[model samples]
Target: MTKTNVIRQLEKAGIPFRTAEYEVDEADLSGVHVARQLGQPCEQVFKTLVLRGPKLGPFVCCIPVAEEVDLKKAAEAAGEKKAEMLPLKELLPTTGYIRGGCSPVGMKKKYPIWLDETAELYGEIAVSAGVRGMQVILAPQDLIRFTGAKVADLTIV
Candidate 1:
């Protein structure tokens, strides 16, 4: 189910995307390893983080896994005082996707997605493809449109 209709969102939105598959070892699912495996810089690989905000409902924020999320900053971006990284157990059901497979797109509900401004520095960015061992590469701006995400300073600045 991860690959089936998950990618349809990209097509329906007319978003240009490319697929990269790799062997996902039983290791920590982080941006560093993903970038290494994909043969791309860590900054080019975006990690989809699911956080629960008190005021903004559930929101999906994407940032370089190489960089840590500024919880308070994320909260402010979501118009809240703070945000917390939800537990994997809580996140799976809340997002209707697994941790390593969680994508900012194709969610159970439409969330206000936010991308760290730094990600826009690159012409291409990589994100999880609704499954582990898979990534989809596309323009950062296209991702903003596909997910209707707001591009903002969502970093720990």
Candidate 2:
């Protein structure tokens, strides 16, 4: 059993999931190497984004590679006047992730995490393993249960 904080939480909550590990240089975050190494389509590889409302408030969103999160739509989802991806400088301190490796689980705070509905289209999705060099494949429903995320129409196009 892996000894990550996320793993501990999953086990404590009794969420069923499988862990996948791969070797990849950490030079790129969105360069698509992990998906290829994992033998999964890019569409099945999900990414975690930490966004803040235009008003400088906190928000979190996760979307599959198959779609993009409309910032305006995301703002509405967060009940804010507007939304935008926070600056990398801000994300590093606020979300505690280095721009690309942020996962919806085990964040610094329990901010609102909205998962795009399209993610549900896949019975299972690969998400961050709460650390670099790893990923977790699990039922989408299980992720929802563990992350306390609400399923929402998070994409605009």
Candidate 3:
């Protein structure tokens, strides 16, 4: 498997993860499309989102590819008054990851991450591998432990 920063970090942490590579279309990069490309159900694929909250400067969130992050719920989970998506222009600088390649693991800094509670339904889930065209699949619980993520109802049903 081609090792990316995320994979290397998982390896170092003794986290067992499997990788999958797919053709990427930079112009049409979306989590839903990624799931389709990987031949996986949208629910089994999670997308990493970075948000800026009124109280917290920046935070991370993960939700199913097909679900949208519930801002109110996310704010409650983050213990903030409100949370908004970090601007695209600021994403790269703030998280050290481009919009389409952001992963909850191995970010420039460990921003607090809130994972959707639905993740627990699956034994394993796929997330971006700090790069486009690559994905990593691992146990949701292991992902939570590695990222110190809080499980909450952060997505709209």
Q: What is the C-alpha lDDT of each candidate?
A: 0.84, 0.77, 0.92
Between candidates 1 and 3, the TM-score winner: 3
Clash pairs, model 3 backbone:
none
CA deviation > 4 Å runs, candidate 2 = 54-56
Residue 157 C-alpha lDDT in model 3: 70
Instruction: Kindly provide the TM-score of model 3 when superposed on the true structure, using C-alpha atoms.
Output: 0.97
Supply the global lDDT for candidate 3.
Answer: 0.92
Q: lDDT tens digits, residues 1-157, model 3?
A: 6788999999999999899998889788888899999999999999999998987889989999999999999988999999899999998898888988899998988799999988999999999999998999999999999999999999887
Would you give me the overall lDDT of model 2?
Answer: 0.77
Q: Order of candidates by lDDT, top first?
A: 3, 1, 2
Residue 7 of candidate 1: its Cα lDDT? 81
Number of the top-ranking candidate, with TM-score as the measure: 3
Q: Which residue pairs show collisions in model 1?
A: none
Q: For residue 52, what is the lDDT in candidate 2?
A: 83
* Candidate 1 structure quality by residue, lDDT tens digits, 35-96: 89899998889899988888777888899878888888888888988789887888777887
Give per-model CA RMSD: 1.7, 2.1, 0.9
- Candidate 1 local accuracy as lDDT? 0.84
Q: 128, model 3: CA deviation in Å?
A: 0.5
User: Each candidate: how many clashes?
Assistant: 0, 0, 0
Question: Model 2 shows how many backbone clashes?
Answer: 0
> Which of 1 and 3 is ahead in lDDT?
3
